[model samples]
Target: MKETAEAYLGRPVSKAVITVPAYFNDAQRQATKDAGRIAGLDVLRIINEPTAASLSYGMDRKEGLVAVFDLGGGTFDISILEISGGVFEVKATNGDTFLGGEDFDNALLQHLVDEFRKEQGIDLTKDRLALQRLREAAEKAKCELSSTSQTDINIPFITADATGAKHLSFTLTRSKFETLVNPLVERTRQPCKDCLRDAGISAKDITEVILVGGMSRMPKVQEVVQEIFGRQPSKNVNPDECVAMGAAIQGGVLRGDVKDILLLDVTPLSLGIETLGGVFTRLINRNTTIPTKKSQVFSTAADGQTQVGIKVLQGEREMAADNKLLGQFDLVGIPPAPRGMPQIEVTFDIDANGIVHVGAKDKATNKEQAITIQSSGGLSDSDIDRMVREAEQYAGKDKERKALIEARNDADTTMYSVERSLNEHKEKLPSDVVEAVQAAIADLKGSLEKDNLEEIREKISAASRHHSRLARPCLGKRAAAARLLLGGRPEEPRKRSMRRRSRGTYAESNSQVVVRVRCIKLFGPWEGQDHEIGVRHSCCLIAVTGIQSCTAVSIWAGVLH
Candidate 1:
């Protein structure tokens, strides 16, 4: 995708702001960053998808509380944000990573399968190909029913039984389709409610609601969003492209193309350390704006302890064992003291990219230990470095392989075009010419089987040469017809014009005189054909004669033809 973008823009793309679901965990976000690094991109920011969509809708410039409801193909997310003075701050975000349009499609697909089974007495779901067709038809009908009252799904010869082939046909109405997928649509409501509750606001506080993603285009989904938010979903932006537009807008800001717009995202989950007695301690709560830090002082669990283990964890669970353990480290070198006497200050810091850093400092001795939590789901630094090295090692071979594939594609295309032309104009050419063109086509086809790029290109050129020969006769006929259309006489050729200017100097002396000559010559059309033209030649010469010797020099000469 990076290469494709570069090809389209005719330049290298190095920096990008990627978007992920707001509910993506630390591991998931880190994995996304790792993917960008592997693709040779400097990932500027990993913004949430809903936030990006809000930006695309120009919510950054508006002053209000807005809800961005995003239901894409495979995931759903609800984000509540407050926009003021060009600063868009996310108040809260909630989502179901598994519920989305795919679920709706599957629900409709199951309905069709059940109906087919009841009528034909054969389970179409048992056949892979039939199931695939049903899935396609189900998705099409779902999209159609969004705009129309009803749609017909007909798959001829969907499957064959021992008796004979069977056809599947069904008409699904919008009401019935809604009935089948209403449960899936309702799953999105609780997330919105949770997001609103986390944001400390009710439905009335939201000034506007923005719908995003392909599934959000459904009328039923829109109705549900309106029912949940007490306002119709905003249609100010395209649901499918708003996320991408928001990303592009953010990229522009990073590139200094935009100004005065601030984007503040919240951490999806809480971050804290384990306290004494296996209890979870919250330093930074979930939905808190990031690039933030909090510190709390605790003491050693045992008497006269010199070291304290800082077990960092994330999640909303009250027990340390229930939450995810991010990383752990020990702050040592503390002066021995009784329990609850030594001051061990534990600080949790979350950066703008949602990466966590945990540190513990012994206030008594000024000793500190900190760890940057690495994502367990992503590659390590050494692994990324090794992969980058391997990519550089094989870069030339990859280019060569791509060139070979392109050469083969070009050869195949030329062969197809030439074969088509030969069949169309076979009567216009002599038998020998036709045969020669066919033989060239055969040679090109045979070269396609070999791995030699130069050989395939040579065959392609040869085939084009033969086809050009065969086309000459047809070209003459077209020319004659054009002449006949122009009152039985060929059209007058366009005139050619040339202009020239020159300047030089001659020196005179008692013993010697020198002359410098610079000439530029331009030629006109060749062989009385206006399209076949010649080129220009320029040369400079110097001649000198003295009392005792004579010298001549040719300084420069160039010819273009």
Candidate 2:
């Protein structure tokens, strides 16, 4: 990252604000900071991926409740935030760090491999290169099907059979692909509901929904989001570039290049310590706003307990042993006292950088121990220096190897998708389209054998562009037919309904107009009910259905007008 920045700016770069998964624990976050230092970059702060994506979206807009749904290559994060006055305050965040687009690709890959093995009696999974090729093909097919209703997956000489060599070829339609990944996408629903519950808001209350990450481009993902939120997800920002744009925005905030923006993030997990019977007692709860402090008092459990053991932990589990131990310290030299007599205060302070500082004080003796905790599972300074020197030494060679692998991987994916398109649409495609696609495929294949990674990348991108262009008409036709089936129009936006009613004991109306607003509880003990109020004048009431509690007009009545 440092080298990339330096090369791009034509100057030395030394500082960065990195983004990580919302579910990353303290160890993972610390590891990220250490990695930044290893790359010769000063880590300013660690931010959450969903939060960063939200920052990107809220940069140009203000005053909306947004739910950020980010589905990346291997992780899914959902964050609910209230944006107002240039402040992005996260209400709740939930995610599955292991769930992402890779899972979709793997599901398709497994299906293809099974089909190939059954027909040709060849298990492609037994060969690493064959499996890798199939994975590339599967990912490309997935991406292509996002824009088109149907796509082909074709890999030449993917594996060897008893006869000689065999190729894997198959047709994947959008419907079938949706079936394959729908279950995986469905996995995000629970988290969304959970986030709403945590935020004390309903899905209907969210004013805007933002989708980010590469996988967010999938039409199926958009549909699922709409089904859950009852609103269309915002397409104003690019899913792939939004996070980086947000990080850059955050960097600007740090350098004072940007103004009037405030970011408030939360800790992903609870921070606590062990108490009596090894029970975990939390001081700072998960999702609590940071640059915050919380302290809990404790008494020694054993008789004549003089010293208290402070073991810092992180996680939501009840048992201290089941959670991750962040760090530990001891408070000693206390006046000997019976059980439950000594007053020991343990305070946890998490700063802006998200690093923790623990302080333990004995009120009787006024003795204190303050420790700046780096990490319980982080590498030491010497280890970081060693790794950095080693990386610097081997940087050139590693870059070449990485670039070559990436180039080959991209070329393989593009060629497979292009070949699939050519095979399935050959009869219907224009002659020029057919010739151009075939030539592009051949050129990409030829570039794979050369040592030039840049050339390989260019050929792969060119082939992908041609394939998308040829497939666009088919996708358009499918979309048009669906629109026609749905009354030749797109879904209309829902409007909030408001009504006016005259308020009187005998229902008498006057020449004056008045407004009133009421809300009702939709579920639970007070379900299907409205608040009763004394009628006094002609009024208008805007009854919002999705908010949590039922309420009558108060001082808010005058403001509604």
Candidate 3:
């Protein structure tokens, strides 16, 4: 996939921001990053899937609370976010990693298997190949029912018995399909409720609800979402592509292609250490924004304690044994004191990457020990280093290819912009200038065909020069012609307090006419100041607004009393 992207972009792509399910733990996120590194990409950030969907919907530009309901093939996640001034901050997130459209398919498959077994007096589940076919048919029927009221599922020669070849066939109605998956749909409700409660907001506070992932397309799922949020789900974005689009948007922000938007994701589970009596002590609660730190001081469980053990755990469970143990370390050399006499400060710190660091300090001695909880289920450092070394061996060839692609892209952009400008202002521009720009555009196009980086760059420079020279007196003739047609004689420009404001006056048979013009060039040498053009007599006041280019003017005139 990396090679394919590089081929299509005409460049060597290296950096990326990957999206993962919001419920993924530290180990899962690390595994995803390791996969990217193995693919020769420098993973910049790991964002949540639902958060990325919101970005694709441009929720960052809106101000309000939003709920993202994401139901994919094998997982369901609900996240509540507050968006204000291009900042998307996730307040809470909840999901079932084992629940999704796949479960729905399985439900339908089981129904089919039961029906066939009852009819044929033989359980199709015993046949592996037949069961596989049934599973596929069930999935297809489920998808078909999403758009239609009913669908027919038929697999010829699916199985055989003493009665010769047998065929499996059935018609599944949408209502029946809904019935089969209603239980699975109900599972999503509790998560939404949990997330809303965690965010400290009610359903009424949510301004918009966005549905993402392929499973969100089901009518039953949409109905459930509407019932939960008290409004129709937003259909502005494609359910299947929004997550990927959001990731691309994030990538643009990191590359400086986009600006102003900020994303603040949260840790899915709590981080803490074990305390007295095997109890779990939470320092950082679940759904808390990351890159944060919390500390609490505890006394020794035993008298004359000289050392304390810090067992880092993650979860919502109350017992240390029930939670996931991330790492453990002992902080020794503590002053021997009576129980409850010494203060042991245990601090839990989580960085932006969602990695946790636990530190313990003795208040009396100021002696501290810390441990960084490493990701367990991913490649080791030695494996990553070997993969990186293998990739670097081809760096020279990749560099040359990247240089050529960049040069060609720059040349193409320059040619298009210059040609578009010339075409737009052709009538106002001198014929010679128009012809010169067209020639430069043609040269640039020809150089692109040769794929010569140096030649293409030279052509781009030449085209830019012609494009820059297009700012010469293009609008003066038109302004003068309009003034003459209005039956007024051009008068000498009169100085005004504002350098950009100028007035012209002409005499008609019955009334003295005045014309005022202010031209503010948005770009080039005349960017900051405005130019005044004279106009002939008219018994009206003309106001021009949004003066973007000297070559184009929009005038709104009103009759004077």
Candidate 4:
């Protein structure tokens, strides 16, 4: 992928933001980063694939809640997001990593194999070539069924019987295909409902629903999404490339080419530890926003227990034994206190990558221990360190390249802004100031054509200074106008009074002025209209009359004497 991107762009692509399954754990995420590094790309971030899909559809520019249903070749992911102010925040995400389009193909393949065996008395599943042929045919048929009512699955020389090679031909209809894979498509329904429930939103509340991944093109999958969400799924983004597009958008954001876009992802599962009585105690619940930290105080269950075992678990189960064990560590040197006396603060810190860091602190001793749970499985520290070192080896060159790109981007943006300002305010500025601004812009533009980053930066700075100098007069005019709109300026203090009123009835219209006024500005211009009012009569209303407008801009109101 890195090579292809670089080749297409005709440039060296050193940094990238890769998208992964929203439900991917730490190990899977790390493995992706590692792969990027191996390909000579600095992995800037690991974003959720569904979130990327949302970006592809430009959903961040819209408001309200959205759902991204992604069913890829080998996995399924559903993400519920709240979009506002160019921010896409994943409220909840859920998926089965092993379930996807491949499953449907497998289902069809099983049926075909069974029928072939029954018809020709030849079990071809054991033959690699025959099985591969059948699998490919099944995949093609599945895709064709999505668009048409029926398709033919035919393969000659599918396998050899005791006599010779045999041919397998079958007519697969859309209804039959749906029937075979309906269970697999239906599997996503509960997860969609669960994700919505976790997000505290109802199906009707979703303003837009996006479908991504190649499998989402399946008619059955689209029907399921529409049925569950009560609206036709949005096909605004290409099913196969939306995730990549989103990743590219993220890369642009990192490079400052894109602005005001934010992504807030969530942890896919609950993370906690085993407590006393073999129960699971959750610290960070599933679907909670990422880069979150929570600490809970735990105590020894037995008297004089100096050591405590902390077994970290992940899942939605109530019992520790039922959940997946992530990792475990022990806390020692507790000073032999009674059960529940020593305060052991177990802290769960899940970073933006959704990787968890578990820490235990003995309050009395101020000693702490921390462990990073490997979500992918038993990857040792050495393996990670090696990958880190390998990635760092390219850091120097990549850093220089990144600096050059940034300098160029900065130069281009500054030149554009300066040019625009020069055009907009040239009439208000001195002739020499405009000339200097134009000269600076020309110099900056010239520097952009060169390979010298330092020269480009210097020109950018000089151009910005010139632009600021030219903008001073226009800025001063704007400031003076703003002052005229507010109040001209403050003047000497003078006394004033404002009447108090109660209920609408005349009997209760008279009320005490219990508050004091310090200074007030009446509506409209106040070049010399400032006034300072002293405390009014305690129980009698004092109405401040006169002034041009009815509204008063009180700078200070306090208790009266």
TM-score leader: 2
> Lowest-scoring 10 consecutive residues by lDDT in candidate 3?
552-561
Q: Give the per-residue lDDT of model 4 (tens digit) for 414-509.
A: 775566546655677888898888899999989888989889989988997786465345444344333344444433232334444231111221
Cα error, candidate 1, residue 143 (Å) = 1.7
Q: Write the per-residue lDDT of candidate 1 for residues 417-536, one digit (tens) a residue.
A: 576557666777888889999999999999988899899889988987775565455544454333344334444331222233133343543322233333332222111111211211
For all candidates, the clash counts are: 0, 3, 0, 5
TM-score, cand. 1 vs. native: 0.68
Give residue 58's lDDT in candidate 3 (0 to 100).
Answer: 71
Query: What ranking emerges by TM-score with the best candidate at the front?
Result: 2, 1, 4, 3
Model 4 TM-score relative to the real fold: 0.67
What is the RMSD of candidate 2? 22.9
What residue pairs are clashing in model 3?
A: none
lDDT of 2 by residue, 1-561 (tens): 787889999999989999988877777777788889998888998888888988998888667899999999999999999999999998888889889999999999989988998989888888776787788879988899888999877664465434443656688999998898889989999989988988899989999998988898899899999999999999888888888888999999999999999999988778999988899999998889888998877888888877888998998899999998988889999887888888898999987667778999998888999876666556888999998898989999888989899889867766765665566556657788889888998899888788888899889878876775554343333443333343434333212333454331122234323233232322222222233322222222222232211122222233322
Write out the backbone clash pairs for model 4: 27-376, 494-532, 497-544, 498-544, 499-543
Runs in model 1 deviating more than 4 A are 304-307, 330-336, 392-561
lDDT of 3 by residue, 1-561 (tens): 788889999999988889998888877777878888888899998899999998988744767898999999988999998888899899999999899888998999999999988877879888766787789889888888889999877664466655444557687899999998899999999999999999999998999999998889999999999999999999988989999999999999888999999888899998888998999989999999977999999888888899988889989999999998887899999888889998989988887767777899989999999987766644677888797787688788778889999998778657655655566667668888888988998999999899677898898889887875554444344444434443435442322222222333233322323334332323232223223332223212221222112222312111110
TM-score of each: 0.68, 0.70, 0.66, 0.67
